[model samples]
Target: MKFTRKAQAKWKGSGKEGTGHLSTASNVLKETPYSFHTRFEDKQGTNPEELIGAAYAGCFAMQLSFLLNEDGFTANSLNVNADVTFEDGSITQIVLDLEGDVPNIDCEKFQQIARKAKEVCPISKLLNTNIQLKISLNN
Candidate 1:
């Protein structure tokens, strides 16, 4: 029940003027471009915070789905969104927005499960930031 994934980053030049590319063993990203422009200047590419948000969203969604199934409800659709807040050169907060359509589930129970998921998700535990959750149930 243990696994490891690898991604590599290569950079040339200094911080402000430097350019870099990231590649992963899964090949989901292949020499993807990332730099100061991409991270701060609203340019075309990816950044570490953006990637972390993506990973958190995906993990939360999957974890929520598992919990719903365990609760005897089958989710028709689940959407999870993570907003990562950066302040004072540090990641300050992570906000999770979750919406789900599950059969035979009450809003109260769904929200309860979502709260549990937010508390137990691996990334939520890994990041030492304030985790805020907003859950919406669609039948």
Candidate 2:
């Protein structure tokens, strides 16, 4: 299966002084703000890196849940957060922090599933940045 989203950005002026609006072909992002200041602070709308982090985090969590269910365990809750760092005009790193509560699953098994999710999540597969995963499991 394959899926794709089309988004466009329009910027004017320079890096520090310029500002831009991002829009999606499907209208998911309608004139969203993307600027250096937005990346640093007041992210009222969205930015490219933040969107990447969100996509990674959400995809990882969903993949983990599926793995848990396949192992005859159900997740009470799953929370995944990804931090994507940008440096030297490229994506430097992506750090994933995940917490999961799975009923009847031991820590070792949970860790294994989390590792699998990190390895197989679509966003992780698509990214070229250095990636790190930190997972915590609770009864």
Which tens-of-lDDT digit does each residue in 24-133 have in candidate 2? 89897889888878876765667788899988998999998898889998899999988899888898999999988888888999999889988998888999889999
| 1-139: candidate 1 lDDT, tens digit per residue | 9999899999999988999999999999999999999998989999999999999999888888888888898899998888889888999988888889998999999999999888888888888888899889888
lDDT of 2 at 40: 67
Which whole-number lDDT from 0 to 100 does residue 22 have in model 2? Answer: 90
Q: Quote the positional error of residue 75 for candidate 2 in Å.
A: 1.0
TM-scores of all predicted structures: 0.96, 0.88
At residue 126, candidate 2 shows an lDDT of 94
The lDDT for every candidate, in the order shown, is 0.90, 0.88
The predictions' CA RMSDs to the true structure, in order, are 0.8, 1.8
Please give the distance, in angstroms, between residue 137's alpha carbon in candidate 1 and its true position after superposition.
Answer: 1.0
Global local distance difference test of model 1 = 0.90
